[model samples]
Target: MPINTRRSARISVIGLRGIPDVLGGIETHCENLYPALIRDNPDLDITIFVRKSHTVTITNEYKGVKIRAVAAPQIFGVDALLHSLWCLLICAFSTRPDIVHIHGIGPAFFTPLARMLGLKTIITHHAQDYLRPKWGWKGRLFLRWGERMAALFANHIICVSAALERDFLKIYPSAARKTHIIRNAPSSIAGRQKPDNDVLKRLNLTPGRYILAAGRLEATKNYLFLMDAFKRAGLDDMKLVIAGTFVDSRPDYEEKLKKQVSENIILPGYQQSEKLTQLYKNAALFVHPSHMEGYGLVIAEALAAGLPVIASNLPVHREFLLPEKCLFDPDTINELVSMLKRPDYSYFLHPVAISAQKNDHWHRAGKEHMRIYRNLLPNSAILTPTTR
Candidate 1:
C-alpha cells in the first residue's frame, strides 16, 4: 500500500525483536494487531520498527503496514536498550511519526527522548519487568526507572490488563488520567486443516494423551517448577511436552532447567505455526506455571483452542480464566501436580473456552486501540481522494 502522508495520524511502533513469526508476547501481539487496525480504519498509517536481525528475509511492509529495521547489537539485554535509542533518533529525525509507540518498559527508557524531539509518544506497559527473577539488582533498578520515565513522559500509557493499570495508578497517582487498559489478544491464525500426523508420530505422541506447556524457557515462566510437578504428578504413561527455546540472555538458567527433565517429559524447542496449533488442539491439558505476565496470553490461546488449562494463580491469569479450580499456586509444586492428576474436563470446558475465545478476538482489540488513537488525534482521518 502507498504511504498516505495526508492522513493526520502516523503511528510508529517500537520495541520487540521483530514480528510476523517471532515467539515473544509483544511480537505475537503486534503481528496479530496492526493488520486488523489497517483493515478496520481507512485513514490510519502505521509503521513498525524492528531489529535488523529478525527482519532479514522480510520486505519493508507487512499487511499494508510499513516496516523499518533499526540496527541493534546482537548482545542480549543491551540489544533492546540500543535499538530503542536508535529508534528514538530515527523517529525524531526522519520518520516523524505522530505517535511513537514504544512497547515494554526497557524501551520506554527513551520515551522522554522521543517526547523531547517533538514526537507524540505512547508507551505500552507490557509488564513490570523488575518483578521478574531473571534480572539482577542493576537490571531491576533500570527497569523500575524505565517504568517511572514511561509514566512520566509518554503522552498516553496503555496497560495490557486492568491489574497493570491499577498497579501503575497506585505507583504514579498523577498518571491515572493518562493510563488506559487494553488487554492482549490471541493470534488471528486459524487452525490448520488437521493436526499434522507426521509431526505427532515423530514425537511418539497421540491426541489428548500429552500435557502441553509453551513459552520462553526462562525463570519467570517457571518451567523448572512445571517439570518437577509433572514428575511428581505420577502419570507415568502420559507425557509432559514443553515448547519454546531459551533466549540468549539466560543460558545458565536454561541449562539448569534442562538438567531436571525426566524421560516422560518431552522438550520440543520453539514449536510454531502448525506444530504449535496442533499441540494446543490435541493436548489433554495446557499447563502454564508462570510467575508473572502482563497478561497471560498463552492461557487465552489455550482457552481459544478449547484445551483445558491449569495455570498459575496470578491476578492476570484470573482476569481471563473464570474457574478458580484451574489456577494453582505458582510457587507450590504440589498444587500444580494435583491439578495435573484431576480427571479430564475437556467436555465441561469446551463451551466455556469457546465463549472466552469469541470475546478475545483481534478485531475487537484493534478497534479498541483505534479508539485510543482517535481520542488523541480527533481529526486523524479527514478522508479525501488522491490521484497518482
Candidate 2:
C-alpha cells in the first residue's frame, strides 16, 4: 500500500524533549518549523510530540497545528538519551504518522525499528556528535557507529551545513545523494527593533559597548578560550556577556574564566525570549569561539540583529559569515585583540548580511522542510529506492 496523497497528509515530528521549555538547537528548530508549516498549508495536519515536562498544552487550534505531550523523564546526562528513546517508542505506537521526522542521532538509533513497523523515517544530522570533546573514547566510538547507522537506515539524512554535508560525503560517500544541506535560520525575533535602555538595566548591564556569546557552558563551545581571548584583547570599557546554563563537564572551567577576566565580564545564566533579544540588540559585536559547530545558528541571529560577528575560523562558521561581516581565526588571540582595539568598528557591519539573514528566516526554513516532507512521501514516488 502507498501513502495517500490526494487527501490532506498527517505529519508527526518526533524526538526532542518537547516545546515551550525545550532548549538548544533542535528544540528551537522544531519550534520555528512547525508554526510556519501551519501558516503556509492550512490543510496539512501537524502533530508535534513533546515531553510531559512541558508546562503548556495547546487545546485550541493555532495556525492549524496540534501538540501532543507524552510522559517521559527529562534528564541531561547519560539519561537524556534514555529519556528520548522512551519518548520515541511511545510516539511510535501512539501517533501513526505518515512521516516520522527524528531530530538527532539519539532518535536515529531507533530508525530501523520505526522502518520495521512500516513507517518512513527522516533523520536530521544536526551536529556531528562524535566530534564533541566531552565524550570519552568509548562514547566517541559509539556515536561514530550511531551516525553511520543513522545514515544507513534513515530514508533521508538532512545536514544543516555544507561542512557537515562534506563530512558525510567523506565518511559515507555512497549516501551522498541522500544528504540534503538545509541551513538553520535565525529566531523569530531576529529582525525586531533593539530593546531600549530600561530593558538593559533590568538585565544588570550598562548601556555601553559589549561583545556577546551565548550557548551552553560545555567544553565543545570553548568558552574559556573565549574569555582568555577577551582578556588578551584588554578592552577596558567593552564587556563580554556570556549566557547559558552550565554543565558538569567543566566544573572549574567557568570559575577559572571568571577569575581571569576583568570585573566587566557578566554571566547572567539562562534568559527568556525578550531578554535574549535585548542582549543581541545591545551588543556591539557577537563572538562565537566554538571549536566545532554543525551550523552556527547564533551567528545567524547576530547577523539578523545587524551586529558585527567574530567567530572561529571553522568551516561551518565560514558557510554563513560573508567576508565583510565575519572575522575568522578565533584561535589567534592577537588577531582578536586587534579586532577589539580598532577604533572605527562600524565597517564590520554589513547590510547585505543582515538582508540575507532576514530572507533565511525560520518561516522559510519551515517551508523548505515541508518541501522535503512532500518529496519523501511514498505516494509522491519522487525518491529513488535505496540499494544498500
Candidate 3:
C-alpha cells in the first residue's frame, strides 16, 4: 500500500514505555493504532519514542510502520515523566516530525516545547490524573498545572471518551472547539479463538465461575472496594480474579487488599494476551470498578468477549455500556452485588455490542488521527507524491 497523498505527512508518537505492549493502556493504544495508520497511508512516516530498557524488538517495519528507540533509564519512580522529557528533547532535534502526537499527561508537559519547534502538537488527555488517589497534594497541584498548560498549548487535544471531553470542557471551556473525542478501541483479540486449557492450568485457575477484573493494582482501580462489595454481597460461589502487575506506589494498599480479600479471591498478577483471553472467555462476569477512566477499554474487551459487565457508575462507563448491560454506582455495593446475582442475559452480549466496538477500533482511531493530521498540514504538502 502506497501512502495516500491526501492523508498524512510524518507523525511521531510520544509516551507509553514503547509498544508490543509489555503493559498499560497507552502502550496498547500505540501498538494498535500505529500499524493501522501505516496501512491507511503507506508513505506517512511514523516513529514511536521508546525507553532503551524496553526489550521488545521493533523490526524495521511492521506492515510499514517504524519504531525509534532512545536511551533513557526508566527509574523506579520518575520513569514516565523523565522518559517523556527525554522523548520531547529527542523528537524536537532528531525526528522533527510534522505532527507530534503525545499520549497522556506525562508527555503533555512537553507539548509546548514541541510547538515551539514548529511541530503541530496533539495531546491525548487519557485521564484525569490529578484526581487519582496516589498523587499527593503537591503532585496533584503539579498535575493540575500540567493539564491546564497542555490544554492551552497543544494545537489540538484528543479526548479518548466523551466523559473526558466533558471534564476538559469544565476547565478549558474556550478550548473546547479544539478538542476531539475519539474513544479507545477494543483489543484486536475480540473475535479470536479462546486459549487452550493449559493457560488456565498454568495460572492455577480451575474451571469455576469467577468475576474477572484486569488493570494495574493501583488505588484508583478500587479493587479493595470491589472485594469488600463482593464479600458484603455474599458472593461465595464466584471467585474474584484480579489480573495486573503491582505498582510500587501502593505496596501497603496491595497488602491491605490481600489481607482483606476472601479465600476465593485470586491474584494471578499480570497475564499475557493469550492467557488473559482464556480468563475472559471462561469468566462468568467481567467487572471494572475503577474510580475514573478517560475511556474504559477493558469494558469494551469484556463486552467483546460476550461477558456481562459491572462497572463504576462513572460517566465514562455509561458512555459505552448500554443500560441493560451495565450496573453503575460506586457508592452502593449492594447494587453491584444485586447486578452480579442476576442471570447472564445472552442478548446483552450480542454481535451488535461487538460490532459497536468497531467505532473505536484502532484502525478507525488511526484514520481519525490522520484526518486531524491532514487538517493541520499545509495544503501544498498534502499533494506531494511519495515512494511506497
What C-alpha lDDT do the candidate models reach, one value each? 0.81, 0.73, 0.76
Off by over 4 Å in 1: 1-8, 190-197, 345-350, 378-381, 384-388
Model 2 misplaced stretches (Cα beyond 4 Å): 1-7, 53-64, 74-76, 193-198, 247-250, 254-262, 378-388
Higher-scoring candidate on TM-score, 1 or 2 = 1
Total backbone clashes of model 3?
1
In candidate 3, which residue ranges exceed 4 Å CA deviation?
Answer: 1-8, 54-63, 193-196, 206-208, 260-263, 343-355, 358-360, 378-381, 385-388
TM-score head-to-head 2 vs 3, winner: 3
Error of 2 at 116 (Å): 1.2
User: What are the clashing pairs of model 3?
Assistant: 3-43
Q: Which sequence of candidate numbers ranks them by lDDT, best first?
A: 1, 3, 2
Per-residue lDDT tens digits for candidate 1, residues 1-388, read 4444466578889998887777788888898888888888756789999998865346688898888887888876788899889888888898877777889999998877887888888888988889887788998999999999988998889999988888888999999888888887776543457555566777888888999988778899988888888888889879889888776547788778878766678887877667788778788888888988898778778878877777888888878755777778999888788777776655336466557775677888888887777666635455545556
Candidate of highest lDDT? 1
**Best candidate (score: TM-score):** 1
| Candidate 1, position 106, lDDT | 93
Q: Write the residue-wise lDDT of candidate 2 on 1-388 in tens digits.
A: 4443344567777776556534577777777777888788776777776666643443434346677766655444445456556656655687666787888765677777778877778889888877887777877776777687778888888889899889877989988777888888887765545544365686566644778898877778878777777777878878888877664355666677557545677777766556778888878888888888888888888888788777788888877746733565756677767777777566677777777886776677777787788876656334333433
lDDT of 2: 0.73
Q: Record all residue pairs in model 1 with backbone atoms less than 3 Å apart, i.e. clashing.
A: 244-270
What's model 1's TM-score?
A: 0.93
Question: What are the per-residue Cα lDDT tens digits for candidate 3 across 1-388?
Answer: 5565554477778887766745677777777788888877777888877776763665555556677777766565467778888777777887677788888876687777788888788898899888887777877777777688778899988999888899888988988888998877888755557565577676556554788899878888888888887777677677889988776356688788778655688888777777788888888778888887878788888887777666787888877646644655776677777776666534245455655764556777877887888888776457656667
